[model samples]
Target chain A: MNIRVADDLTHAVGCIDVTHVSISLGEEAEAFEAVSDLSFAVTPGEFVCILGPSGCGKSTLLGAVAGHLKIGGGQLTVDGKPVLGPSPDRGIVFQQHTLFPWKRVRDNVAFGPKMRGVGKQERRRAADQILQLVGLSGFEHFYPSQLSGGMQQRVEIARVLINRPRVLLMDEPFGALDAQTRNMMQEVLLDIWTEIPTTTVFVTHDIDEALFLADRIVVMSARPGRIVEDLRLPFARPRVSDLVTDVEFVRLKRHVRGLLRQPEKAPQLARLDPLGVQEA
Target chain B: MKVIRCLIRGCSVLSCVALWQLASSLHANLGVITFRNVPPPTEVVESALALLKSPKLLAHVGSSLWRVFAGYGAAAVAGVAFGFAIGRSRAAGDLLLPPLELLRPIPAVAWIPLSILIFPSSELSMIFITFIGALFPIILNTIHGVANVDRRLVASARSLGGTSTAILFEVVLPAAAPSIVTGLAIGMGTSWFCLVTAEMISGQFGIGYYTWEAYTLQNYADIIVGMLIIGVLGMGSSWLLTTFGQALMPWRRAVETR
Candidate 1:
């Protein structure tokens, strides 16, 4: 399988800059701020995880970068270009595998290229190649409904990656999987990232998931989310499952947990979807 | 267990027929109803066999089948097209829905007089009534299906670089297919109902015309035969539609069986 590699010298392509961004959910009259005056920057090919409690608006922040949700204040830019609307250059993988149920796995993966007007044979070849990268080569002919949850998310990742996105945005992509499958997926994701080396911004409530996957973890506060801590991991590349037991890893996890803990007096906020307000 | 279930089903039908045979032979009458004028299963079978051997049987069945196909085919195309338009666009819905909603409540029987005037010939009028019978169910169901398509799927398709036209065809259409098929199956039944009613009123040859002709000629057994034939045709067509729908959606079967 042939995979395209990013040029070593052109470090400017996938850079993301978020400055004093705020987002609100629901109608104008009743709307509440989900993320308030947050700022972050990601260098090209860096894997950054947005770690937050439930309803902390981390996913909402990812949505702004993906150009799916509108920002109420401040600016978001990719490679010096202001974010506008959803673009294939920034691929997103939702927590639920948003694979087209009607399409076979091969077609689902091929969809991005097909939309770009690639011919049937060529796009299908690309789909097959990418499917192999995600360890789903043999399951091409199966429909999404036929695949297990882990396999479905694998296909979802492949579908997004086939676009060769400059920035891969994942909103808890393995959050729905069983603990065993989630662990395996986290490793599989790292392997894929090793191969393609795309800039990644992953959102998750799971502390271990954030610690395992990210080069840097941006921990966020509860609703009306503000950045509480930005921690850089010292652990070396090609991370293994056993790294979680490492003393440094455990210490950082504890520190991140403490950062995530909210004040007892603060009221719990209902979860907001990346797409803005949750429908009644 | 499967064989026993089949046997029980078969016996149930046989017993119903046996009861019908006993009632008709005895000329059973109650205050509100009578089986004296009704034809027995044995007489209906004989009449059905005689009609099957007659040359006119082909003409009657063929005309009915042709009218149904022509009217139903048109309804399916128009309904789905209109459904997609209305479901996707608020402007299209506002423009198209009011007149359709107004027209929907009028039964095919009520349309017979207006259609007879609107169409140049009786054949066209009967077909129009059949078209009317099918159109509303197909259109309404299609709209319902399209409107209910998961927003996430649409959002995903757009994020994947699908244009509006591509998204509508690839994502919205397939997502709403199961609902559209249900509409089509229901529409087929109503098409038969409307066609038969229209044919009885003015048709020269059709199953409905034959049934009405039999009543006027006092051939009550032939009426029962015509009714049975109509029932069988309706059942066969609905079965074909559902089977075709299932074949088109292989993914749905995998989900359902799982």
Candidate 2:
């Protein structure tokens, strides 16, 4: 995989753009091509969902944008600047709860800023604010082990948001939770997203989840993963908790499911480029 | 309920004493030879009481304690630093491990003669033996801890903008702590055992010195008493180490309770 930006392509105003991205894992036997020739632009404060079968590098794409993974081919530039490494501008929320067992909820949230050289006094204040935003106001001194699974995930989000990242990369963040708690977490995430309108890339396998949370859903395919479809979610902005019962949300879920079912044993998914290239 | 438990324990101790007396009476000649012919438990207790009152016991205990603290302390610090390096870096682990594995199997007490030859002072030699007793276990445990730390933790930290050094200190150390602490506890016990063996080298210090001196004099009662003292001190020190170590590990009992 190789990435080169044509010197003439002008930057879109206030959006994170990917110019012909191709991601590969390694030379190991049966080493699948993860993400292939995928490109999309996330506008400022855009909530985009990359939905696919498990292990198709949806998280890898997020990792690339977050500067955690090296881009084999593609430039993920935020605000006309290349992502160097994980800067405070790109905070990632992990699928499994990554709260450090040693630290209390408050200190865990305070970690990124503390690492980024924020003053102790100010970082603590910001941590408190983020904790409050994530609905963990009273759990400041509580350790991760003391909290339930749902609460632990909340701490994970609060920890990332404390840094005030411009792009929030979430990799199946609520996949481990029970259905009831997952839905509750979805609602909490929406509330948190509302307060700080960071452009979010949420990667998940759940069709209902993609519809519930995303502004645009990019359905991905197996193995040499490429965008199969980019379904623009018609659900209105500030997605409410009640949207689960919305008729359009059900239609959207069925529509995404139909697309997913078509590619189960298919030879390859036709690559999608919403800008110009209509078909193979 | 606590009193009843204590009373039961107390009764068990009394029963043990009674059995000892009963055995000694039945085999009077052998019982006399057991404490090297110093009569029985009654006579040994008298000698132990007399020795307890003497200031010599303090000097012996103090010197031994001092040697262990110096040696074990140095070993723990060095072991942890080097262990983290070996654990985190594949290059370093490969470079260092073969020699360490070779050196580790040689008993720490086996170093006493070589340590004496290498260090100018016997005092330093004893400390060196103690350090050897501890250093290997601590380093090996620490290395295993760091190397085998949860992969997700490293990835998660990387995703959160953590540098290699930051992840090593923050995530790796904390994750490997329980294993490292177990190594340290084992290392301390071994160090103490080596300390006693090392001080028996005609040095006029430590429990081993007193123990050897008692054997030469053949004051059988004192010899028995000395052995008992060493056992109790070793047990006491280990207990302290484990108790202190447990305070750092809140997760241990938490899992059991869970």
User: Candidate 1: which stretches are off by over 4 Å?
Assistant: A1-12
* Candidate 2 CAPRI classification by DockQ: acceptable
Writing each residue's lDDT as its tens digit, candidate 1 over A73-152 gives: 99999888888988888889998888999999999999999998889999999999999999997999998988999999
TM-score of model number 2? 0.88
Comparing to the true complex, what docking class would candidate 1 get? medium
Error of 2 at B168 (Å): 3.8
* lDDT minimum window of 10 residues, candidate 1 chain B: B151-160
C-alpha DockQ of every model: 0.60, 0.33
- Cα lDDT tens digits, model 1, B170-231, are 99999999999999999999999999999999999999999999999999999999998899
- Could you tell me the C-alpha RMSD of candidate 2 in Å? 6.1
Q: What is the interface RMSD of each candidate, in Å?
A: 3.1, 6.0
Looking at candidate 1, what is the lDDT of residue B47? Answer: 93
Q: What is the per-residue lDDT of model 2 for residues A227-271, given as tens digits with 9 covering 90 to 100?
A: 889888888867777888998888878878887775446565333
Model 2: per-residue Cα lDDT at residue A70 = 66
